[model samples]
Target: MTALAGDRLPPPLAEGDRLTVDDLALRVRVSGRRKRFALTVETDAGLTLHAPEGRPAAEAEEFVRAHRAWLVAKRGLRERTRPLNPTKRLVEGEVFRYLGRTYRLALVADPPAGGKVNLIAGRLVMDREQAGSPAGGRAALVDWYCRAGRAWAGRRLQPWAARMAVPEPDLEVRDLGRRWGTYRPGDGDSSVGRMSLGWPLFQLPMHLVDYVVAHELAHTRVLGHGADFWRLLRSALPEYEERRSELDELGRRMWMGEMS
Candidate 1:
């Protein structure tokens, strides 16, 4: 880690590096460049401001204090659910809930040759015959998950899009480091749009995955979660709040093991 210089120890954050304003909430992240300080805040609803690194602690607190009312209001509306972390996730003998159905993670060794791979009786069956080494087993499992995830997304999003009277956006699997999914509509044409869906693994519930898809799809019409956007989303999925809560809590758990 790099340390701040003594002379520039208390640099003030730049205006460009401020909070983000989304339709739903305002949030920010603080960072510092070589010799300058920066803050970022996002707020479509209220305001979120990020503090720059190496800034005086008091100044950072004061910055937040200046926007305390907005912070308090948005914080109250923020999702409070917790996500699953790396330590608690496992491969086998674990019960996972997806699409309201429970499945168990099963690890099976393949023979020395080759065959098909599948998940049977809630257990992921590996073709030991195709295994070149013991390490390949985990790789094979993740591959299976990627394949399953792509196919699953296609199947689920198709009908939903048709019912919602929205054209299905292009779907692709990605190894996004931070976001699970994102939507990008054409400059101004609602008819033209694009979306990217991430696949951390297949352990997450299908509803959560669908919720993300729906969220992104809604962005095709509403760029941000303003009142109109939320209203449009609610009209389609009355239980969106519950789904969001579920994802906020259990989404990270799915990616806990075999990755981090």
Candidate 2:
């Protein structure tokens, strides 16, 4: 199941039992007070529901039946937005994007004595290139991407934070799969003041990357995305709605395989 942001839980339900509006294929949850019934619908496109607790099941079912067409359309839209998974694994000859352009992975090995990987010319030349051994080559490439991402994220965020009236946020670049970035509120004297930026090697644009930075920075003042949290964010980024969609689309393509 997907997540609902900012204190938006399915309208208060009873014992958490669910009923599927068979006519609409929409899922309804009965919860909160025994008398109160909540509705939750699942569609990949997004969530849409009309919840009225303390209503009879027959009444709730009728409401869902009336919206059957809308529910179907919503599910179809969500399915289209799901992340794409390629059948082929990442390897040589595979195309990957960086800085708005695409590059093909090429393996080459010619070392003086020790192994090293460097971006020579336009290709990723590996000093330990063994056709059967892709581990070393992959490590070199991932390291390169991490370095590039850290520099790119810092440069883009520094100026934006300053202009928005937020304090300078320290940067920590690391590989985080579950989350993209986070803001850490400083404790007392010795605590470090900073933000943690996660750089997964993918082709997301600079504006979308900055959105995450701005999102965390706003947390410094308004810990949650209540109405005030959104207002604070809009003050810095007026077009956040568009940016959020872009990130969701691009963030899905990022690969996170461990290098051996």
Candidate 3:
């Protein structure tokens, strides 16, 4: 990218080329539909400048320079919210979370008669046999999360769907690796969509969980995270940006089946 003259624009960037903005390295993404430059700060604090196709590199540089203050502030926030993917041990007093609340792990001699694990007296109780084996304990805990997450998400779906004015899709909680949630629209013989939320998402606070629910609901009407999709989401969750930021901060710390 180079300084421009008269209506001329720099040659389009190559596949792996980077956009250089003084002191800041930015990835350039040219979107034909975008009317103005858009700057994105990712969860990892990576920078991307989304520009309308054929915009001069100098113009993009000026835009980034003008918004340097905002980028700096957002980078600071991202730095403060760095990833903390902590591993867990099945020993007593090991912490677990359910809907943003913490509960300690407790070992018991006998299995609770009905299940591999149980929330007894605000502690996650597992029989000695299960807790003694990390693999067994982890499987039992994830099963609990899947069951609990499905039940809770089931009850909350109708209300959020109503608020978003979209039909509630069939909800399933499972291990959707690297994604908090996903919506699969119906096809072929099925007319109803199915929304799959990761079981680990159940460990976040209710508000953050709701954020993901509403987010997928928005997809019920709009598929991509384009302007229209965000606009629809904003209409339903006015404070979605804040919720998303909080989710980015705390979600990385949630236990994702890692055991020690």
Among these predicted structures, which one has the highest TM-score? 3
RMSD of each: 9.6, 10.5, 9.0
Tens digit of per-residue lDDT, candidate 1, span 1-260: 56666655545444444433333233445556433322332322335455555455456555555666656565555424234355322345545443445666554563333334466766545554434343464456445555777788878777778656778887776656547788877666546677777656345667778788788878877888899888877877889999897776777556533432
TM-score of 1: 0.56
Q: What is the lDDT of candidate 1?
A: 0.59
**Cα lDDT, model 2, residue 238:** 97
- Off-target runs (Cα >4 Å) in candidate 3 are 1-82, 188-190
Candidate numbers sorted by lDDT from highest down = 3, 2, 1
Superposed on all Cα atoms, model 3 deviates from the true structure by an RMSD in Å of: 9.0
lDDT of each: 0.59, 0.62, 0.88
How far out, in Å, is residue 151 in model 2? 1.5
Pairs in steric clash, model 3: none
Runs of candidate 2 with Cα error greater than 4 angstroms are 1-74, 87-90, 111-117, 128-136, 189-192, 258-260
lDDT of 2: 0.62
